[model samples]
Target: MQRGGRVDGATLANLAGRDGGSGWGLKAVRDVHQGHRLITLPSGCHLTYGANDDPRLLALIDKVPSELWGAKLALQLIAQRLQGGESQFASYIAELPKGFPGIPMFFPRTALDMIDYPPCSQQVKKRCKWLYEFSTDVLAKLPGSPEDPFGGVAVDINALGWALAAVSSRAFRTRGPTHPAAMLPLIDMANHTFSPNAEVLPLEGGGGAVGLFARRAIAEGEPLLLSYGKLSNDFLFMDYGFIVEDNPYDTVQLRFDVNLLQAGALVSNVSDALGAPLDLAPRTWQLQLLAELGLVGPAANPELNIGGGGPGAEVLDGRLLAAARVMVARAESEVAGRGVERLCAVDRPLGRDNELAALRTVGGVLAFALSNFVTTLEQDKALLVGQAVAVPQPGGAGERQLQPPASEDEMLAVRFRLEKKKILSRALQRVGALSQAAAGNAELKQTAGSAAAKKGSKPSPATSKGFGSKKP
Candidate 1:
């Protein structure tokens, strides 16, 4: 390469129709063995956030909110792009994508609305709004002024969006979390996969050169792939403009509300002995337990998750499950003095009734959440596969023919929601099994009690109600 970068067994090629049609990727020119270094670029070649030395540009970057670091880097990239041949990294800048069609920030209003998940929708709107305001309120007035960062050249929202997308989709944090990210030229071209074939590592002795090594033996003509992170679809879609099929790291967010829990308890057929409404109000001991688990009180984190974040993670958050179990408990003796860890463990059942109520309550909550989606899981699947399906119209008016996704954004949105539904559905199945087991245990206990009464002998204290405490 012209800029002191080395490519040994790999060559850049147009990899259209592969890896979500990212347009370009690095392919193996020859067989590469495990641990072989594939590519290397010196530190000087990295396009970092703090590399730009212009005082005006630095001042503007300072004014930009720290949370909007992407915008700061976008400013630097735009400045370099405007410089053309005069810029030191002009060739690298020229090779960047002219436009980012895949990014949601560039999606039209109709396409944007297709992203049904509120968490991701809110983020996309916030970034788009910031880009619009910054372009109109600040960057537009920079031309012909002493504080001009782009040398009298105008920077518009479109250009700003392009730079922001480029940075978000390509940049990597080579240094560490606290430092600004850097855009590695050829290294960034490798497409992402959950199971990566190659990995990036710094050269030995801190020489400032970064190297990419093969994680396993590679055949000739294999495209190099890298793992971005254990990110959920919410992040993968928003930051990288693509979604993974059945990503193991995906999660569905829910707020831990007592009202929702109460509704779930009611749906699960749980009732009070006193014939009172199922308020699900936490008792003092239960409140203390929830607070200790960090699910309620001053330091509580009410955000709950339905799916796991990575391999071997619980389908439901431990703290959330523990809180639900504690909330449904009828008496202090049912869960008194039990540590949070034991309550959080799925294998540790407090009692047959308590376990059934907890599992059924969780199932009810999942069902309620699923009901909020605009389309059914079956309809989503049919639409994703380009099948023409008839869906019921609102208010029982009539059925309407649902068409396939019209654009990539719509397809991704459908895919996002579909995965979330899958997670919820899987979790529901699990809870159903647990609930059945708990019911079976309860029936066995009841049969034993009936037999004990028939014998006219008192039931063993150990087997009687409120008998013993779980070992801490």
Candidate 2:
């Protein structure tokens, strides 16, 4: 077996417990101080692209292109595992998890539909199909395939899928000869957490070596956890087969259609013109203007936090608000026969009228987005309230079941939608208040204008004071 760098004091050891199920995980043998070096894997220990040079393996590797480097490595692991006890990776393969939990990629379409996380499910389905094809069409067709010369057993698609999942979750991107991803024996064992207690850093001398250090003091026997970077539950489920509760980085994607914006502009600005259908050309022109301003497009998949944030902050992305404000002005100009330049200017101050218009426009935009998820939100809430079942399958009499009110993924989906609702609810409330306040301002201006016209002079100073003092 190939061993890497020497770990000081044997502070780290592999242990099996509920923490990692049947899979082995790294644990602290003794209370370790913050910044303590726990484990290190030298360059030679890493399993990287083109690491195995056997003629059969090379023939398979040559069939794979560099862009699919990770797939090649996964295939290599599968090939090695087929060799069983004779394989160089026998020890490593033995330590891997027996099965992955809640991995959508491995789940059938019916199972994926049960999870209801469409983005992750769709991506997994697409990738799984590719992996299956590569296994059946390419790798299985190579020389010595019929006899299974590498091992006594044939390498099949199911084996490839398992190896692929393992590699996807555990391998680290390394600066190897090909500078591709590799599996580091001890380093990959550290589990992930949002608040990680330890971190992996590249070795100073650069022998493909990496050191694990505690971010804070850890009690003896505590599991060594690492941050997989700040990732959302969607990414966590799709790539790692896990979810983090209350993940601060979690966000839902919201894409605005230009047609929706135009429709909303017409409703907000020209609703009273019962006889005339509004001209859509102005709204379309404004959308082009928004595009030129670098505000809206395919790439502008703005994220909406389930939690609350300011207008220009996280909740309603700033660029989205900017585009809405411009669209509202364009709507007004179409009705008032005026220019749309002032509203488009970046440096101009947002006067009271513009603020009111922008608020109404942005409120409509948020409402449209919130409407798309209403069914999902309701379904999630219903699931959270339902009772859990605990019966085994009819044929599997011996198996135990822990059916809950909802699965972990189901609970997470509910929580995420709840937060999004709260944010949109708050945004909508603000929009209503501002729109009302804008109406009051307009009324007050009209009343003052009448008084001034009757007296043939500007409004009295006392009236001006009352205008500024009126409550919104």
Candidate 3:
């Protein structure tokens, strides 16, 4: 490699091997201070390009088969490659010997050419088409490098990893201080949370010393929790479909008594408020984020709307989720004078006796309900997205036919799980607002039409009193 001109003492600290000479066992890393940010990547890579000029990197690619590729999977695979892999992936990194004459490390373009498939495979061909599409102009200008497959250089490990996964993937940068090539080793050891520990202090010079700070006061045997990312309740739900029971990240965070459920609800609300729910389609998301954003209606408050819908919806990344949650918490603060109740009316229903009981119940299960509600909210919102499988209302009108028609055969499709009956099915979303319909359909006020209005009749003055349009 180039005469060791990396961070101070990084090379002296460890050989350019994956082990980094410290074989520190994975106990999970947590940040000790709040507002601590460890800069992971300074920038992204050019598609199919790497810093390496080594002919050996390219030589290795000649040995790899370029035939194996799946086009539909190719997009996801490329995204995965960009994000990199888990910390444990260092094992694979360590396997590559340093000072090798050819293929010093995993190469970028080499990895693309290494697809192990037959020449005629449609997937492989599709990926090739994707590369061409990218190279041409689909996503801005792409570079064209038709170098000899045999003598191309090894792709940078980070670039290859990024190709494997996008920078946004949760597993992208989860690795601890395994190699200097990664974020300053010990710095990564401090995990990330939406609310992070103070791991960074301003230094006299330019760069700050990245340290692992404590999120809370430590007692012996407590598993320190470093924030992973600004994971939203909706994103989390989309990811795991419920509160993280088996998640290695959050479960370990719980040792510090971090309440994920409470955080999740706040995430859901703020994401909703920001007019960014799950953007299923790229078109819909572009409209929301890049075009008209926020819940308030357009220009003169003319068109009413809800945020975040469609198939292939874009989820709120961790950074935005974390900040939005803070906004939600502050907005709901009674002292802040906004007068927004933290819970929906149905969640804490009215009535003297019921209210008292509800208070006790809320007090008793605040933590439990927080997680449960966020989980339910996520599932419900996913339904509203309704892009993947959209069918216009089927069956006779008002005859109780399923919306977005589903066949008996479709419902009958069997998925054999070990505990088939134990896992609960996700609840469907209410057509407009799952929140109003959370308890039941009865609570939803039909501002547009009720049974009387549907029958060509006008509603009584009392019934139509306070209904207002929702601006988006």
> What's the lDDT for all of these models?
0.75, 0.56, 0.25
Residue-by-residue lDDT tens digits, candidate 3, 1-472: 1221122111122222222112221122332233323232221211222235235323423332333111212233333233445322343233322321111012234322221111112232443454444434322221234442222333333333333222112222222222111223333333233443323332333332233334444433233234444442223321211222222221100110112222322233222223332111122322233122232225322111111222233211221221122222311221122122322222322222222222222222223322322123233233334323222233424322122113321111111110111111211122112233323545433221100111123222211111112110
- Highest TM-score: which candidate? 1
Clashing pairs in 2: none
RMSD of each: 8.6, 12.3, 17.7
Runs in model 2 deviating more than 4 A are 8-25, 51-70, 108-110, 143-153, 176-178, 262-285, 293-313, 331-361, 374-379, 385-472
Deviation of model 1 at 43, angstroms: 0.8
Give candidate 3 misplaced runs (Cα > 4 Å): 1-166, 169-184, 189-205, 215-223, 233-472
> How many clashing residue pairs, candidate 3?
47
Q: After superposition, how far is residue 98 of candidate 2 from its true place, in Å?
A: 2.1
lDDT of 1 by residue, 389-452 (tens): 7867879899988788988878877888899889889888878877777777744322110000
Question: Which candidate's lDDT is highest?
Answer: 1
lDDT per residue as tens, model 2, 213-321: 8889988788888887777666676667765555555544444444454444444552212323223233456666565546456654333233223224344445545
lDDT of 1 at 196: 90
Candidate 2: TM-score?
Answer: 0.69
